[model samples]
Target: MNKAYVTFRDQKSRDRALAVLDEFRWRKSTLTSKIAEAAPDPIVKAPEMPVTLSFDPDDKTPVNEKVVKSTTPLYNVTYEEQLEQKKKAAYSVMRKLGNEMAKTNPELQQFVRFHKLRRKGQICEVDDIKASPEDVC
Candidate 1:
């Protein structure tokens, strides 16, 4: 076993020890504050660039490319892309509904055929089928 003994010979020695402790405390506080003041502020970065997308049904996968338009932000581009996706989904639902209607209404079939012919650059009549008022009810 080991024992250590600390002795203050007189009041003067005790006062000197206290003064050293006080100086050490003051140094520590000043050093801490100095470090805090010297610390640099955090850095902020700009958001990512905007993207423009094109849908090609023929290809197995979708293609996307980044576009840098003047006066347009990334968030706006993303929002526009979302709206375009929604429009595409709505069109898909409309086509499905048209196909279902073609079972009962031969007129819709002719309209669909007409659109196909028009897409192929052939001259076609612009006849659109309308449901009878009674059928709607």
Candidate 2:
């Protein structure tokens, strides 16, 4: 039922509404308290080992000397280096295209320069490729 009685006019209706609200509040508080009381207590920690049994001299061992070499050259360049190379390649291509466009039409020189300068820094840092240039603009 909707608690908001918009059309209630008489004094009796208002008194009854107030009583209902008080009962609702009382029931909510009691329910919350009961739930909290029934909740599980914080977990207990395990006991620590005795001093005599804690450490052993025999447990200490030298590091392994064996080394394994891979046959494939797959990891010659790391993922980060590869991503950097790709970004550099992309920006280089963008610069070349902008240079050509500016040369072909002198009217577009300012626009091409704007495009080139906008992507001067780490182009790969931005997630949105299209908006990267617009951001600088």
Candidate 3:
């Protein structure tokens, strides 16, 4: 088995990698629950507002204003709820991907484990294991 360490030259790459890992973890844990929670609720059309206009003869100007109003759906979730739902979805995807990777490249399994360890500062070196030609699924 080969160990792989997570490294990025820039903060953006590091952040992106970390986010991907987090999403993967979430995907593995609560995929079904997240999907069920995110299912679309009953759709309702928003109420339209009336438009009013006024004309000023002195300046020969027409002023128009629209009163726009919106109502939240009964099943609408809060921002925090939405974020949690997203995190769950991400975890599900990550879990699936990890499983696929394990099947295709058994060596990569160790790399992922090492990466996780490195992330926690529990590991210092990650061996770069090359996959066998037959294992390259």
RMSD of each: 28.5, 21.4, 26.1
- For model 2, how does the per-residue alpha-carbon lDDT over 1-137 read when each residue is reduced to its tens digit? 22332335886885676556553555345211111123444443223433454445675543231111134333567666666766667767766777778799899888766655675732223342332243565
Residue pairs with backbone atoms closer than 3 Å in model 2 (clashes): none
Cα displacement (angstroms), candidate 2, residue 130, comes to 14
Ranking by TM-score: 2, 3, 1
The candidate, 1 or 3, that scores higher on TM-score is 3
TM-score of 3: 0.30
lDDT of 1 by residue, 47-130 (tens): 344556765667654223223333333444555575566655655665566566666778678876666456442223323333
Against the reference, the lDDT scores of all candidates come to 0.49, 0.52, 0.50
TM-score winner: 2
TM per candidate? 0.27, 0.33, 0.30
**Candidate 1: misplaced stretches above 4 Å?**
1-77, 119-137
Pitting candidate 1 against candidate 3, the one with the higher lDDT is 3
Clashes of each: 0, 0, 8
Residue 37 error for model 3, in Å? Answer: 42
